[model samples]
Target: MQLNQALEIFMHGEIGIPSAENRSSRQQLAGLDILHSDDVWNQQRQIADEAIVQSHAPAEVLALLADYQPSVDHRITLVDRPTSEHAAYHAAGYRHSASEVLLARSLNNLPAPDPRYAVAQATTIADMEWLNTHDPAKRAWLTVTRLLEPRLRHSFIRLDAEVVARVRVCQVDPAHSYVTNLYTAPNYRRRGIAQALMIAVLQQAAALGECWSVLIASEAGLPLYQKLGYQPLATLTVFEPAEASE
Candidate 1:
């Protein structure tokens, strides 16, 4: 898929439909797509809000975000834009929080799943809560994703009776799948668990007739994704209240 097409799919997946409980919302103000989700877990690490810069002037977008303040602490994410464009936001008191690369790959020729490890899908709220016993915030995030994202699935592999690695996949539409939060336990790093789990995810997406999978990858995870045929699309820069950073 073209970079533009992949980005469109990625943005749509990120700004998903709100849950039935009304815990989140998406809006278009000042020619920017903005999102806000209540941090139900009350954890600082939980995501609260973001702004996607399309063709909007940075000044206009900043003013809109400034006016519509959310009740809880929030951060804004500006995706696929140049560092120069981000300077205005930085000057406005939003400090850099993180950066990640957008990646996409065709699911046409996914590798076979590893035989030794059995991959399991978290299909219910109960399943997610149990698997994420170690982190309530992560568990809450997964539950929210299950409610907000379309055709959501969380796949994982266990070691020593605990989840050692996992990935979340969303079938955003008929032909596209979005992957996020691919994580491995610190102790399990360099064990090939993440690669095997992702192969399983791609195979699952292909089985459901999805054609493309997209994700945001950190520098540490870039090599693994490249080996799996994913091509980088753009850099996503995240920003938060300067006080939050301080």
Candidate 2:
């Protein structure tokens, strides 16, 4: 899939349908598509100029973002394929805050699941709550549980009666699946829980005839993904206003 199209699908799955109160507004400025969601969650607002047209003045993008509520400290993702737009953001006082490497692999021969972990689908609110309780940051994604499009699936692995690891997979299309929110409790890390969980998820995706799996891996997770046979396709940079960096 095209990078921009994959990005749009990834963001939609990540942000879901913004609540009525945090609904986003969009505008085209200098060939840049900007989305402003007054959501306290930074991921809800973003700026993307995937086409590299560079027609939009960076000042205009900054000015528009400044209007967002709690804008100074709130973060936003700046999707620029051509590095040329980087200077505009720097001039606008947005700092390079974080980045993720995009990775993809053809689901040809997935590894066998480790018997040490048992993976199962999360089927109810209680199941999701269990996941968030173990990793509070996941609470922000409660909205994804309510989304119907793209066929969301949540899977978890339990040890004795406690959920120890979790992962979310979105079937973006019959031929593609996106994985996100893969988390294993601190106590459970390095015990093969994550690898096992991923093996199970990808197996399911393959069963559904999905041939490709895509994900944005953090620096720490890069090695594991590489070991799983995913190769870097691109890099996505996220920027935050200067104040937010401070």
Candidate 3:
């Protein structure tokens, strides 16, 4: 598959449901509501041009996007494939504001799970809420509805029945899945909980016939993901108007 196509699937696959009704309402006002159509995903409000560009968009579409203006300071995020079109977006004055490495691996062979921790799908909203509360910065924008979506799975690891680490997987399509929000509580770091949680989630995905797993890894998490056999496919870049980045 094309790099952009794979990136789109991974991007949409990371959207999780908000943890509370109030948080959902707040996200809507901030124009963070995700709108999906065909192979493209965008925001409900056009305040920002947050879109997944098609791999073969015509020149007219590209031109229109280059000229489109929002009422407020806006950012345009794109998955930077090593193609001429990606270069064109950069030539159009979209500065590289930030980046995340897209990584993927086949689910054919996963690491052995750690026996010291037990992992399971979150059984209730309270379970999800507790996980969210422990890592507010990472899950600040997630919604309860998205978390409960049938295609999405939220899993957590517990030590003596106290939840300590969590990971989320979104089955974007039949064969592709995206993983995110793999966070371990501060007190629980260095305990192999993250690896255990990832193994549990991947095993569940493989059982369901989802052979490929993907995720965008933060810099600090790069080493762990690399050790797990996830190789970098492309660098996803976010471009913002110059002032917005200032």
Candidate 4:
């Protein structure tokens, strides 16, 4: 597969959600994020399949490309690789910036003022009961992805993963580390959904004992995150070998 396509699948492959409602929640949260390429990011809002899961989050974020400096972060846990000769899970890591957490947390803390929206307890699986009544067809195109872990091949996301929207944690701490996929979908533009998701994600991380979750925020997202409480650790540079692509 091409690199972009591979990244798309990899992003989808991460996360451990097991319900369709949760799948749609991820996509709805990706409001106006700029990473979806022309083919993916066009009016339709799909991301390139191999665009590099630059940022990592719970399998719900939508904007998939690495548009910002620290735009993408993925969490890896050390475990067995059933398909490879490598040892069981070997790494457990999460990525995303402090700012992303701060901004999103802030939003969730406040009550929503907008009327064209609805909010509910976020989870791995979206509530299907609500969908049957409010959005029955919405589930048809959506999926219930397993947590977006990189190596898991037989999860709900693999069966019908389409977008990456949010990365939420059940437990979080300021010192603990985690990955975030700071994505925003087109249909849900400029509504502070990203910020809301981040704040909630960070709070969970902090509660889980994460002293500082890591992430690469976009230029736009940087100040917001900084305001929320994140400082840059260092710049990560990329150098692809000339023959590496071949």
lDDT of each candidate versus the true structure: 0.75, 0.67, 0.63, 0.32
Residue-level lDDT of model 1, residues 133-222, one tens digit each, is 843124444664564445878888888877888877867888998898678888887878889999999998998899999998887899
What would the TM-score be for candidate 2 when compared with the true structure? Answer: 0.74
Q: Show pairs that collide, candidate 2.
A: 30-56
Against the true structure, candidate 3 has what lDDT?
0.63
For candidate 4, the lDDT comes to: 0.32
Estimate candidate 4's RMSD in Å. Answer: 16.3
Question: Which has the higher lDDT value, candidate number 1 or candidate number 2?
Answer: 1
Best by lDDT: 1
Q: lDDT (0-100) at residue 205 of candidate 2?
A: 93
Best by TM-score: 1
TM-scores of all candidate predictions against the true structure: 0.85, 0.74, 0.68, 0.35
Local error of candidate 2 at 49, Å? 14
Q: Report the C-alpha lDDT of model 3 over 12-126, residue by residue, as the tens digit.
A: 6644333332121111212222222221112122122354433434354345444543424444444454445556556665566666778888898788777877787865777
> Candidate 2: deviation at residue 238, Å?
1.5
lDDT of 2 by residue, 48-160 (tens): 22212224455665665555333334454555445777788877677777777878878998888788777888677676566556542444443432333337788888786
Off by over 4 Å in 2: 1-5, 17-30, 35-88, 136-150
By the lDDT metric, which is better: model 2 or model 4? 2
Off by over 4 Å in 3: 1-5, 14-48, 51-63, 70-74, 77-95, 136-142, 159-163
Alpha-carbon RMSD to native, per candidate: 3.2, 4.7, 6.9, 16.3
